[model samples]
Target: MLKWQWRQGIVTLFFVAVGLLLAILVGYSQPAFRSADSGSLSARSGVKIEYPVAEIKTGLPLPSDRTEVQMAAACLPPQRTPTALSFQAKLVTPEPSRAVPKYKPQQRQEKVHPTNYGNRMQRDVHHRRVNNELLVVLHETVGDAHGAISTFQTPHYDDDNQVSYHAVISRNGTVIYLVPANKRAYGAGNSEFIGINGVEAVQTNPSLASSVNNFAYHISLETPVDGLLDDHPEHSGYTQKQYQSLAWLIARTGVATSRITTHAAIDREGARQDPRSFSFPKLLSYLNQYPRPTEIPPCPLPPQG
Candidate 1:
């Protein structure tokens, strides 16, 4: 009876030891919990999960493209602040002619068709729903505006060669409308916009990488002739007229100053460095002249199946 009791006790002890070992092994296999402030996290099934960080302010002027990381951080959230309207302010309304700068209405060559662009998307590459928030992506044509126009006018059946912009501003401040604002322009490839809402991008085609083109309004400024060389770092800078025209066009869109970004800010591939030698303060000065619209038209909803 004593031996049997001792044997029972030994068996119980062995089982307890085994259980503890198994528990420790399982704990080791599981991922450790981390704070939300850290980068991204993944679930057991391998799905990536993102945590919201603080909102990043925009429209602050920076000197060089090296600070793109800060610029790409976040877009401005919609503001609810009421505009101060005093009696004098209401009485002195400017005429529409004086507010908006003159622009030329021109169409791309017939060869540049719908194939070169796509419709703005309501969802992202993952088919996940996203806000169709409009963003203004500033670009610079490496060559003359006519040269860029010619390239856009040429047929590009190949996906790699396909490129276009909603509008192009010449050195003389002539605004040439290319693709319609409602359509997606092939501006920045492999690009993404990190805003208060989180990462924003769309992959319209499997062959192409994700980009912000779906919700971006692309506007390219023609490079000065002296700065046409690919190796040149900076040029004489854009004309005052160009700055005024850019600000004028953007103001009419009703997009907030914070949503305005440069190509360098969104490019993920690290190759783009356009709209160089730009003056954000100058643009802001002109933009301040226009009153912010009370409401911007929302994107049309996707068709229900």
Candidate 2:
């Protein structure tokens, strides 16, 4: 009876030991519980652990002595913006246009000079051969409209010995008519076009031809009396009235803003300086709002001093 009792005890002990061994094997092969204090406590072949949530909620306390977050932030690039942590919300809106004065086309008191008006015979010849681009070179009338127009007209009497331009601006924002926009004017000196002669060359250049429709136009703005009195020394800084008129004139020219270039830009080596006091950013701002033209005119402006 004692021996039988002992055998029963031994069998019970063996079963208990086997159960514990099976439990340990299962735990070792499967993912286990995650603890709050020490990230996830998982048992797998090759396991990865995430950072403790508690550390994130309250930024980990900096070390007590000489505490610097440098070690923790070392892997990150320096932030340039102060508001980097702020939520971004974009607001797209249209900009308003600046005020502009009115422009009235002037009626020449003296029958516009014979040279100023296009010759009937000359017009017929150029009409068929005209291109679609106009190399617009802006100039500051060193003199008023009257003196400028007169100089271009009376070649023999003028001191510069020769002069010519397509149009002129009077002091009161009046646009004086001269040669037709379609006709070539003797503005730029010793200038050549990419595929044509002189000012017309700009029209012929492939790059310039493309910009003609978007960023270029032709107009001669009249500087204030000071510009003329001092031989247009101050013409670089033109008047608000003339600028207003020029903006309007360019709109009418059907040229693109991109194609509009200063005389100085085109003529690397020349004696023309016009549209003095030009503001590139201001002009670019104006052009950005305007549309490009479809037709490319063949006429171009000359380089100036």
Listed in order, each prediction's TM-score against the native is 0.63, 0.45
Can you write out model 1's per-residue Cα lDDT over 1-305, one digit (the tens) per residue? 99999999999999999999999999998654322333343223343224332233334342232123333332324441111111111123233544553443322323346667877665666786544467889999988988888888887899998899888988888778888777778999999987644686778778889888877889999888778957566787899778888877776566666678999999998778898888899989887777754332232232344
Candidate 2: segments with Cα more than 4 A from true spot: 1-132, 155-160, 192-218, 229-236, 284-291, 294-305
Instruction: Return the top candidate by lDDT.
Output: 1
Please give the distance, in angstroms, between residue 281's alpha carbon in candidate 1 and its true position after superposition.
1.1
| lDDT by residue for model 2 (66-85), tens | 11222222212222111111
**lDDT score, residue 7, model 2?**
100
**lDDT (C-alpha, whole model) for all candidates:** 0.68, 0.45
Kindly report which residue stretches of model 1 are placed more than 4 angstroms away from their true locations once superposed. Answer: 1-111, 293-305
For residue 140, give model 2's deviation from the true position in Å.
Answer: 1.2
Q: Tell me the TM-score of model 2.
A: 0.45
